[model samples]
Target: MTTAAMPATPADPGAAEAADVTGRLDALDDMLRLGGGRLDPRLLDEAGALLDRAGERLRLSGEHTVVTLAGGTGSGKSTLFNAICGLELSPTGLRRPMTSKAHACVWGLDGAGPLLDWLDVDKRHRYARASALDTARSDTSLQGLVLLDLPDHDSIRAEHRAEADRFVTIADLLVWVVDPQKYADAALHRDYIVPFARYAGVTLIVLNQVDRLQPEEVDDCVADLRRLLQAEGLADPRIVTASAASPDGVLGFREVLVDTVAARRARAQRITTDLDRLAERFAGQSGADEPPAGVPAPARAALVEELTDAAGAPAVAEAMESAYELRAADFVGWPVASLADRLRSDPLRRMRLGELREELRNAFTGPVGAQQGDVDNALAAVAETVTGTLPPPWARAVRAAARRHAGELPEDLGEALKDALPTFNQVPRWWWLIKTWQYFLVLATALCVLWIGLLVAYGVFGAGGDGANGLIGDAGLIPYVAVLAVCTLGMGYLTNLACRNMVALQSANHGERMERHMLDSIERVAEAKVLKPIADELAVYAQFRKDAAALRG
Candidate 1:
């Protein structure tokens, strides 16, 4: 994933190693960001410590390596520390715990002052291995080494043992001292070796006081100790037999230190091992592959549909259709019929749907309706669908994300649906034309009836013998009037039928359109309040798994 070209064969191997370490650290930063709270808190803390230690170590000095000397109380640990430092910096006597605190003997202190401070080594206990005059030529090979002597791990005082444990955790290379008598101490193997088995590469075990044994028996003791260490999960454990009393007793162990220092890789190796163990712990809590892409489409659709029903969309849509039909009839129906319609309540108004948007402004604050359970079930289904394929912890995270904004869902849906409903304020031009024509027909029928009645009145009063014939040029006013009345009324009836048919079609279309808009609104609310959060969490997991796999590698 790095675009920067690295040398096919690096001139300096340390540079390449440094670049590799930087890349790993960067990947670890990503892992911490993506998987921080979702993973176990203890594991997260370990990762954070590793990052901080790596950063501080790299900043202090790459030239110096911090190697800790650790062992049980009678393991000759202080004696070995003095032997390595070539000075009696740590007291060695019959004292129960000779080194109650940590002491540092730093070589090449050119820039190691801050490092010692970072390690919290007391000034009184600090010593210099190489002087300014360069007089200690024999110690030149061990330059750039910051050797630490820690308190006895098996000390009677809990504080002493705790101090030893703390140094062991932060040391770049651990030199464990054990006497022949307590080489197989269970506390040593269980408390330290087995728990830090991943640190085998950066660890060294020194078997002190081998001079107490027969020369021939020393090899047998070393071999047996090696066997025990290997059994405790350290493959090919490094063991050295030495004595603090003999001048040349630790020559072989000193040579191992020389090689470790010349390599200048112990610090990076320690941090890498820490990262590897942490990666393994993370892998245990997650699946090998990434989780599924997201909640399936059908599941999302089902959720939206459920929400639509719970929001009363269907009822509102049906009311919209009935309301449209009633209003259309009032606009285009015959005059007498229009007046009758005014007496009947508007269907939407009767259902209180006209005020629905306003009423819903305060609704769904709690379980206020019969459909609230449906909403809850739908939300649960969405959460399950998103998290079903995830590992337990990650699944829990995803489920939590889904429900984080659940309480706001109802109000969001109400707002969306309120915006979705159409205002039925506009009327079609054809309705006005039909209404005018129906009123015209009604007026013509009324006039025709009046004319027929007036002609009859005149003939009955005997003032005119041919009053009926006088009308419409002798075609007979009665017959003409009768025909005009029937034609007008019949046309009115036919027009009403056509208008009713068109209103029915229009009403059905309006109902279908409203249903679609409401459904769309429900989907938007679902996406904003539910599905988006779930998707965001899945994205986090996907990236976390990637970074974790890189760490494992």
Candidate 2:
């Protein structure tokens, strides 16, 4: 038995529709890659395989729509197949199953070989109406159609059934041939018809052995079959009653086939149905009706605060303040007082601020044990806040993304702190002027004291008391020395007071600067370690949702 290929017809009406479906499939492929492991593996694989087949069909034989005749044992599928082609192509007998392998009939041989190759049908024949009888022939309507007679779906041999099922998946249209006894078979309805509910638009049901039934009972049987099909979720399915043995009985079925081929919409409808099925399977993973709003600001601030605490930023800032105050005091305080300050340890050195700065510049190296717990807790809190309202799969994905760099966060934060620490050892130019003025004051005080000592020595050690007393009283030097010494000491004291006040002001300014730097560092760490990952996951989710909606459409 041989079958013919569809004839070349006018421009394909399904080109635009096919393009739309192809674009949607491409979007779905991108979404699957973006979603990573978040989507169900099995569903993804099934969708991927179906898409490949659809793409291959569209590329190889888009101009031809392939329809298959599938049915159970003793259903006369082959007989109907031959009757439709108007030739003795497929053999028929009382055998349990007539056709074991699929046979193809193409109306127009152009561009049909590749499609037949994809369908794995080797036996093929071409049939074209002669130009002389074109006006009388109705078969011209089925110009670009490829008709196949598949092995019985209920064949006793497992391979025959498998072959039939394989062809059913690839065919653009399916025509189920049922005899009177098996029109409502439980296995057929439950396993085949129910599962293909999405393909109802491209499916046709035929009662192939209706000639055996009483004339009065035909209508009742047809009505009952319609109800059963509708119950199986096929609404208003096309049902035709025919007998391949009677030429007139098969005419109605042939007319329907002709119309289907003429419309050229079956291929597009089949692909659209497949896409819808995939969309439905993945709908559960897309949470809520719409994409979520961005993460809250307060939550972000809180996360930064937590990270700062974890990184010991406050401790470092306080140390900066103390170090600045100590250095300032040593620079401007009275010589005597500053000596005591210098004897104590420098706060910045004790904290190793200089070494930390060098380390930050060269490479990140610092211990973060003090605030590691705080950092982890902060990260967890931020992840929870971002994913709290998401569906389970998406929520988990977001949480995982947040912790993608968990092990590196502590080290990164420590390096950030090192960078934030302020330099306190720098000397200002004003200190030099202040030091010179203090030196002059010391000199004046020392000169005054030395002059007073010489006067006292002259008074105590003079050869005669009368002379010394006379000279001292004559010069009035006693009060002169006393006033000079008092004035110089008072001036030096005032100078020390003024310098102390200036140093205090400078320390306050430096403290504020250091605080700002520390906060900025904390914000950066929060952005890199916690916030970026959450954003990435949300991006993938958004794309997934968009693609799913397109496929649904």
Candidate 3:
């Protein structure tokens, strides 16, 4: 005999939906972690909790769509739950709040046990149309549904209320069973209905125990409930009236469930609702939904200027000017002035030039001081400029990022300045040529003095004895010596004047070169310490905004 294998159970309809939600949540977690302190801590915490719960729910049952029956005390939620399941699955006596711990009724037991376990529902019953005593098959449209009978939302015990809230958060669908008398309860409308308006797609409102009301009164009650739902932001909500005590009262409620199950879209719809809620939470905080414009040009220029001052650019440039002038004097000054220049302290050394040069050659290792204050002020200004158009939360995040970037400013600025020192340390070739001319002028002056002295000595010796008649008297050499001495002195004075002008011109050129180097160094520091951090934050914000938009979609 050939035995036909029973048809394999169909794959869980929600598997693809669950996977998509899981991937989105993982991406969100990564984005939040990268954002770190730059995002609102409270929002981050809320998002993390939601992600964890979603993961747990998805893992437990991608085949079953968990629907919760929630209502206030005396709302007959338990009776309605039993009527819908066609069994005595929930206690419905005079216990004030009939249900305490949640009771679940699984339409098909296969692959649904783990979902019940995750939901913490210890009381569970399995039902299937195929196992019914009647030979004729009943409708099996609700095959993968898990219906929950939850404790009253307004129970006297806080734990009962808390339990109701917990299930409500994770359930794929919610059926609010309100009695006619309590249909317009302020607590129900304000606390549950309005807050869950974003979840309208997965919600159903049933007016249970409507058999207690007159036929004429039922219309008025449902109309009143509809108005309240609309006021709470659920425009044109799905609302029905049923009397679970009556045999046929639950048929209407059952038909809605059958339709819901037939579609097999509750799981995907529920996840989509959750994403919508999250996107709403981040609505205002994400700003204009476009990439942020970076810091303004004026603000950037101002920041550079402030940083330059803080890094001692002005002091370094002035030192360069003085040092150049002094150095030039040493190389090209008159012999007498050269000696004085050597005796004086070196200008660059007196200004701590060696330390500054070393700081630039190495990385950021400069001493921190008053200059840091300027850097701080400039950073604050830039932060304000860059984040000015952002929402308050994002602006605060950007500001915090700016502060963090500025922490390394002082050292970085110092290093930049030091790196620029080599540009100003160069010597001009004209200095050496001027020095050679000055040396010749010195030699001529010395020779003239020697010549005059020897002539005077010969005249004195000749006057005492007859051996030598004075050369000065023989060839009018005394006048010639006098004229030569005067010409040598004049030459020395003129040479000294020319050397002074040359040194001054060289000093001016070196000063201009030093200024350019100093400005360039400051610009580098500004880029590292200010502009780069703002750009990084903008990039992060852009990614976050994109993720938010995807979630919304």
Cα RMSD to native, each candidate?
A: 5.0, 5.3, 5.3
lDDT of 2 by residue, 511-530 (tens): 67776787788788778767
Clashing pairs in 1: none
lDDT of each: 0.81, 0.76, 0.74
lDDT of 2: 0.76
lDDT (C-alpha) at residue 404 in model 3? 77
Candidate 1, run of 10 with poorest lDDT? 361-370
The TM-score obtained by model 3 is: 0.84
Shift in Å, residue 198, candidate 3: 3.0
Q: Using TM-score as the measure, what is the rank order of every candidate, best first? A: 1, 2, 3
lDDT of 1 by residue, 193-214 (tens): 9998779999999999998999
Report the candidate with higher TM-score, 2 versus 3.
2
Candidate 1 runs further than 4 Å off: 1-13, 131-140, 338-370, 459-469, 472-475
* Candidate 2 weakest lDDT stretch, 10 residues: 125-134
RMSD of 3: 5.3
Q: Best by lDDT, which number?
A: 1
